[model samples]
Target: MASFLGDHELVKTLLSSGALPNIQNYEGNSPVFASANFSNNKILKLLLDNGGDPNLLLTQEYVYNSPLMIAAINENIEGVRLLLEAGADCNYRNQLGNSARKIGEASLNLELKALLMACDNPT
Candidate 1:
């Protein structure tokens, strides 16, 4: 609900009130993962900036995707950049042995692929 709203201030207030940023919904998805899945760049940024764990793995039925993988799979370039900047593991692979770069390639999202490659290099 709140995750899809793009209410950054409300989210901040909630976090200040001690709301757990990593709380999973009924379907076992956290707000950060939901923001990534929905391609909500602002929400994703807010979550990440407010201490959402970039490395938090999804334990739901979707079982193998990280937030970076999901953002790359969905072709959300900004989301990918944000996650990468927040120190997400660029080489992190899911059960399918796919890293963000591979996911971006499979999705044909050149921008994200390039970003992941750049992060991987970082020299």
Candidate 2:
């Protein structure tokens, strides 16, 4: 759970020592999910740089949310931008049949909503 605590340096060191970024907790939440949920931009960036897959779906608890969805729901504009720039699927649908765009809209976060719209029409 150190990674979940937003210790960017420690998390990076652990990852460098071969700590699997894909490892999940008891509830099956990945590091990426934790970082997104907590709005930890530093941890998120470190994880992304270290091969954390933003597109990885939560298969256990909270299956209705994705890393992108979580970021959007949390109004994490930078996190959402990072994930999108990292090639996360902007149109991914979760168990609730909602995409990141929908989550952003539902969040009522102007910045996140704008980011999602930009993602939806990149160019």
Candidate 3:
């Protein structure tokens, strides 16, 4: 709920109350994963800091399932950067075998594409 609503206060309360950040819905959308669909970098960071698995792919049929992929699709560059800096597998493929780079390419955001490219071959 907090993640979906981008309610940082509630998220902090839940985390303090021992809520598991990795808990997912029936559709395999974890709080962290759900947060990635939006540009709420703070929420995503909170989840990640609370032990959310950045690499948890969505198991829903036909869903991209990866946080990084979702971030790319949403054109959430900051979200993508946060996930990558937190150790998300940039090379991780989704249900369609598309990596974050491929997803970003499809988004047509040259900056995002460049970011992924740089990540794939960091200098």
Candidate 4:
């Protein structure tokens, strides 16, 4: 909830209060996933800083893939950057055969596509 709302302070307090940043809901979506889907980089950073997994995958049937895929699909440059820095697999393919680079290429943003390609070999 807080993560989806981009409430950085609330998320921080929750984390400080022992909130599990990586706890996925019934839909296999975690706080990091919510933050990335919502394009809230601050909340994403808060979650990642508190042990969120950037490469966490959605278990069920969700249109989105990993955080990197969501960020890339949404053309969220900073989110993609942060996720990549946190070791997000740019080549990660979901059950639907979706990958960050694939969606990025499908999008109209050439710059984002270029970034995805640049980080093809993510560390």
Q: How many clashing pairs does model 1 include? A: 0
Question: At residue 40, what lDDT does model 2 achieve?
Answer: 93
Which pairs clash inside model 2?
none
Backbone clash numbers for all candidates listed: 0, 0, 1, 0
**Candidate 4 — which residues are off by over 4 angstroms?**
62-64
**Which consecutive 10 residues in model 3 have the weakest lDDT in total?**
114-123
In the range 1-123, model 4's lDDT, one tens digit per residue, is: 889788899999999999999998898888888888888999998789889999988665765589898888778888998898888888888878878878877878888888888875643
Residue-level lDDT for 20 in candidate 1: 83
Local lDDT at 93 for model 1: 72
On lDDT, the leading prediction is 4
CA lDDT, every model vs. true structure: 0.78, 0.83, 0.83, 0.85
Show the colliding residue pairs in model 3.
58-65
In terms of lDDT, model 3 sits at 0.83
Best candidate, TM-score? 4
* TM-score of every candidate: 0.85, 0.89, 0.89, 0.90
lDDT of candidate 1 over 3-116, digit per residue (tens): 867677777788889888888777777888888888888878878887898878787765657888888877888888888888888777777777776676666556766787
* Residue runs of model 3 more than 4 Å from their true location after superposition: 62-64, 121-123
- 1-123 in candidate 3: lDDT tens per residue? 789998988998999999999987888778888889877789899989989888888877866568988888888989999899888887777656788877766657888988887775232
Q: Provide the global lDDT of candidate 2 against the true structure.
A: 0.83
Off by over 4 Å in 1: 121-123
Error of 1 at 93 (Å): 1.5
